[model samples]
Target: MEPDQVLSVTELTREIREVLQGHIGTVWVEGEISNHRLQGSGHQYFTLKDAGSQLSCVMFRGARSGVRLSDGAQVQVHGEISVYEPRGQYQMVVKQVQMKGQGSLQARFEALKRKLHEEGLFDQDYKQDIPKYPRVVALVTSPTGAAIQDMLNILTRRAPWIHVLVFPVRVQGQGVEKETIRALEMLNRAEAHGLPVPDTIVIGRGGGSIEDLWAYNEESLARAIFASQIPVISAVGHEIDFTIADFVADLRAPTPSAAAELLAPDVTELKRHFESLSRRLGGQVMTLLDRHEQTLDFIARGALKTAPAYQLQTAEQAVDDLEDNLKVAAKEQLRGLGDLIQERQQIIVEHHPRIMLMEAAHRLENQAQQLQQKISHKLERLADQVTSRAQLMKHLGPESILARGFSYTTDAQGNVIRDAADVEPGQTLVTRLQQGQVTSTAV
Candidate 1:
């Protein structure tokens, strides 16, 4: 190389930056932190050192390191290796940081999470809906643990009718994942084993450190949960704690007690609901009957009264008596329904309340349909009577009398002259014939 072909300082620095970035693009470095400083702009500047050498690092505000940064702390950093061209110094552009003790475990966790996410294990479309009223639930956990006790207490208090099956297994430590997976498989094929099939399975344990909870993060356990036929609830830790099992399970409850709460409905609330429905149904029936009675009264007054005067009083009395009888019958029927509901409520402990309520409602509906048909038949009969009376009245009308060769005379004021004494001498009159009228003068 000749002196005349020497490189400029700017060119040299740019070439060094390119070479460092191209060769050692990204890396994870473990060291002790020194000279750590946080700027008002939320950027962190620190020096990572060991007994041998030190390296400059900068974490921008947008980077999420998760761990707190301070001098003298042992930490692991992930970033790109690049040179700051203006300063001509190579530094790590930090993207993430973790404590030295958790760095490897956290890395593995992140890698598995990303892999499963890409495989669609966490997709919402794959999630099954947990039954709102699960009839049977299976719990897989340490039988002696507080988690099982809490869940049992909650289930017993909220829904004493539900059947609970407990599968005891180690919730932590080595080979626990195999026990949990086996429990899930057994519950799914429970009928083949002469055990009752469960509507849901809840796998839970109390809160613990990441190491203690590591079994839940196993890929095989997650796969088993994903493949289970029954809906699975993951209640492995506290609210803030999460595991791969949580992601793959059909539903996630923050705690074991919460899982039980989700599965059970309060019996008292259900009873009140049934009672409210009974009352509303009874009230509606009464209202409908009353409206029908009013319609009957209107028909009797308007159409039945048009019959001959001798029959009019008798028809009105009959309609009034029928309406009173209908009212009494409806009241009796409603009273019987109320009594049936009370009796069923008393025996609810022996039979499923839902089935009992449904049966009662179905009977009430059938009775209402029958009553409606009866009312409709009665209305049809009353309408026929009205038609017959209308026809009779038409036949007995003045026009029919005129057609039968009977005629009436009206005086000058258009009043029917029923008797000869109603006319005076020389009074003008009009006599109506069958088809015409004749003007006449009294003689």
Candidate 2:
């Protein structure tokens, strides 16, 4: 037995605080809170209590300002151990405090969600688009759960021809994370092998409390959903119950039944679309046939219905009628034009002269005839005058006088003697008579 040492309260508390300080500096304590108050300085003063004990907690203004706390709220606290010398007691200096139980789990979930979001793992770019028409669909869930049953029922009702593959997996509890990862890997392996691979995968479970749905919130499971090659539809819990898997999956359905409806097509809608297309095609074909028949009827009633010789005879008759009409019109027009010209000529004659041009031509011809008669008479007169003048000149000639009474005597050279003194006694002489000249010698 150790002997007890009596000491003052200050020393006793100081020793106690020294022992508590080491242990409390790094420990997690869980309790329900009370007497929570915010001081004027913005520090928090609260009491942590349990069924058998209570503890005083002080969060300073700097450390507790952003912390939201309330009375009767459950919490887990972490802090260092210290003693206020003035108060003469030991207390915890809280570094951090968090809501306990399910609230803590929710906070962790939100943190991881934001982290994965920043990495683009939960982005639409990473999500696979659901196939418009899935030929083979793979389902991942508890084999005995109602979710699987609902999905199977919906798939059969919507598209009976679609093939279904079941990959049994645990939807809750301890080993679920590995099973989910395994199931996705199996689907990928089947696809790589060219074996029967599912076009879409439905991964989900029925609704429950958050604890029952915690496995879906695991980061490992979320990563598996992100890495899957096939498009995934998450249908965990009811509509309001969301999990990390929902954000990472390609699609989120409100319920398990809705997920099945989304995975398959609507039979009634497809039938309606097919009927509309058929009606349009039938109408087009009928319209084409009707137009073809109309064209054929038009060709049958054309000019080819008549004989070639009859057509030629009709054309020739038309030409003859046209020629006769043209000739009649031309004759009438010519008669009218001639009457108009004659009328115009008569009017001109009455206004001016009856034969202006004819009178002028007659005058010209008469003048020409008078000129010819005058020219002929003048020529005959000129000829008679010329003969008389010539006869007078010849009768008065010197040779005529010589022939009458005198002789023109000349020498032997035949020169005439004009005077008696020109004669010589020994010279030969020529005498001019009316008939001829005679040559004689002077004696």
Candidate with maximal TM-score: 1
lDDT of 1 by residue, 352-435 (tens): 878788889999999999999999999999999999999999899888999999889999889999899878899999999789
The lDDT values for all models are 0.92, 0.85
Inter-residue clash pairs, candidate 1: none
Model 2: lDDT to the true structure: 0.85
After the best TM-score superposition of candidate 2, give how far the Cα of residue 86 lies from its true spot, in angstroms: 38
Q: Write the per-residue lDDT of candidate 2 for residues 1-443, one digit (tens) a residue.
A: 34577777888778778878866566667798899898999878888899998888888866732236889877878877678767886677777787666666878888998998898988887778898889999888999999999999988988888899988999888898789889988897885666589898888899986677888888998998998888998989999889999999999998989988997888778789899999999999999999999988876886546566777788899999999999999999999999999999988986665477678789999999999999999999999999999899889888769767876787777687888788878888888787777877776
**TM of each candidate vs. truth:** 0.48, 0.47
Residue 69 local lDDT, model 1: 94
List residue ranges in candidate 2 displaced over 4 A.
1-100, 192-195, 296-443
